[model samples]
Target: KLKLSLQEKKCSIEQKDRAISDLSMEIQLKLNEMIHIKTSLSGMSSAKTIIEAQLSAALSQITGKDQHITDINKELTDALTSIVDLKAKITTGEDLRKKLHNKVLELKGNIRVFCRVRPLLADEIVKNGDSDSILHLNILSENSIELLKGTANCDTSSMSGLKSRGNGAVEFTYDRVFGPKHTQADVFEEVSQLVQSALDGYNVCVFAYGQTGSGKTYTMEGVPDSLQDAGIIPRTVTHIFTEIERLKEHGWEYQIETSFLEIYNET
Candidate 1:
């Protein structure tokens, strides 16, 4: 009886030991699962922080670009506004031009027109064998003579007094005072005075009009070869320069620009 009782006690101790071991193994498994979940959560938090930082940086760069674009747009707007205002103050050839023209006419200023003829060559006179060739002899045919006479007498009703001598010499004088003889400086002087008048708020136009081969170009432009043969253009340009220099003495300033244009016949 005593031996049997001892064996039963030993078996009871062994079962207790097995239960403790099983409890320890279950606690270890629960701790391991908690650690794994904590690790996953930590990784997710780090990834979220990195994404937020990148997003914030990208947003800042985009904002800066937008601000730059806004500044450029503002500058362009200001420039356009300035251009509009400047154009508003300027005048063109329309109602304003007509008003200016009327005002100029009211001043009763008359621009002088002068005519010059080149002297006939001595060889032509000798070839004609007429010492009187210089006299009232007409070089142009009758139609041309009539045309020239008409042009000359158009402004004034009186024809120039013409005296034809028996020796073929002719003397002619107009009723009004004649202009200074044709010189290289004549056109420049006349045009320069008109140009200077612009400072006094006057508009001026300088141009040439005449029949073909009538020295219109010669009078407007000058002969470049030599001073004796120089025409109107060079002389006037010199006059203009001198006038500008003279103007500096006064309290006047000028900015000048030149433009050239040519017209051609229709195709």
Candidate 2:
């Protein structure tokens, strides 16, 4: 009986030793598993941080690009607006110029005939008591001449030589002849006064009228012999140029044009 009891006690000790070894092996395996899980979690955390950083940087760049595009859009819009305003101003100016031109044409169309008279000689009259050698002055017509002699220093008397009249009806001195004077400026000034009236929205008409023997032709038409006595047509042209120059003194922009026409009656 004593031997049997000792054998049982030894068996109990061996079982306790086997149980301790199994417990130690299980603890080591659980520790290795925990280490692997920790390493994997760390790697995943690092990858997530890098992705988040990349996402944040990409978003910032997109925001900067969006701001640049917004600025470009604003500048383009401002440029377009400025261009539109300039076009509008140009259109208004053109319309104003057209209106002014039309007004000028209207004023010119409403004018009546302006009569210009030629200078006459005082000697053409006959006096009962005067001898043939004595010079006499006569008043011919109601029309009077515009003498520019007071304005210019030119001597008109040098043209006083008598020339053969066209019809031999009368003889006259060149100085006393009915015609335009040598003062080109004075003539232009006189005509500009009339043209300026049109610019002021007034009507005007210019004409020369007289009897057949009178100096009407000499006054209105230019003659080849007298360089100083050019007709009203040339003087009027100079007046227009002068007026254009005068108007330029102001800030107004203007343009000048000329057109000539003749009426021909076809039988």
Candidate 3:
């Protein structure tokens, strides 16, 4: 009976020992899982810090761009204001220039005369039935004319402008004279300066006096759309309008007024 009781006790002690070993293994596995969870939390915290730093940098960059835009806008507005002031100054300067220019023109000549001789057309020769015109007019100088021959005999002493050279030929003097060889541009070169006098607030008078069909129309109104043959009226209009357009950039404005009247046959 004593030997049987000892064997049963040993078996019960062995079962208790195995149960303790299983409990120890289970606790170690639970510790390892806790360590893994802690490591995951640490990694998440580091990532949050990096994200916060990147966000701060992005916000700072956005603020810098906003300031730069503000500065540029202010500079643009100031530049525009300065341009306005400059335009006003230019307008004042233009007024002063007009006064000075008028004074200079007054000193030069209040009344000036210019003459342009016309070329003989082929139609005129056919109508007259002769290559030679009846009157022999010759240009002695830029401001002088010599009549080579004339049917009408006149006393030189009676005439104020005529000077007798020889053989009934007489020379006349004027302010300025252009020969048939002169082009339309040649005549306008002198006239363009005179046109400016009128713009400077002066009473200007320009007239043409010659026999019938002697180029009065051609000189005043050149061929249409022909730059080379542009007449005095067209050129003067162009000059004034171009000056007006140029002044507009400087804040100067102009109102154009035009009048036209032709006196024909003493009426």
Candidate 4:
């Protein structure tokens, strides 16, 4: 019986030792799971912080871009306004120039005189063997003429009756003088202002007075189809029509009348 009791005590001691070892293993496993959960939570927190920083930087950049766009819009508006004001000022300046030009014409007699020398014709050149004979007519200035000796068919007595110097050279003054080299375009420029005056409700008359074959017809009437060589009448008509079109923008309408009458030999 003593031996049997001793064996039973040993058996109980061994069972208790096995239970303690199993409990220790279970506790170690629970500790390892808790450590893994903590590491995961730490990584999540770091990611959240980085995301917040990026969001704030993005917002700041958006605000800066919006402000730059607003500034550009304001600058564009100002530029457009300045352009409008400059255009208005330019229009005023043009009107003032026209007024001043008209005033000058009124002061200097509405009927302006301009002299033009005709080029020597082919027949005249053949008749006068000396080409230098045509050079006897000297253009002293834009408003003066000097006819040297032997150029005009005037005697000394006849020249004295007129304004002639002792050298038998005659000098005449006029409002404007054009030499033989002046083109049809050049002559029309001087007459254009007068045509403009007529368009502005003023009566204007342009006449040609010279000997026969002195380029009067050529100056008054050039080739009808040629634009560069167009005379004063055609150029004036073209200018009037163009001005009418331009003035249409300013609420202007016009009705033009046409009339042509020629008197030959005063008949």
Residue 43 C-alpha lDDT in model 1: 94
Candidate 4 backbone overlaps, count: 0
Question: Which regions in candidate 3 have their CA more than 4 angstroms from the true location?
Answer: 1-51, 62-85, 123-135, 150-169
Put down candidate 2 lDDT per residue, 39-65, tens digits, no spaces.
999999999999999999999999999
Alpha-carbon runs more than 4 Å astray in model 4:
1-97, 130-133, 151-163
- So what's the TM-score on candidate 4? 0.60
**Order of all candidates by TM-score, from best down to worst?**
3, 4, 1, 2
- Candidate 1, 142-226: lDDT as tens digits: 1122112333212222334543354423433321211224365544544555554554456666666555554666766657776
lDDT of 2: 0.56
Model 2 per-residue lDDT at 229: 69
lDDT of 4 at 66: 96
lDDT per model vs. reference: 0.56, 0.56, 0.79, 0.79
TM-score of 3: 0.65
Candidate 2's displacement at residue 132, Å, is: 69
Q: Per-residue lDDT tens digits of candidate 3, residues 190-217?
A: 8877788776666787877776688887
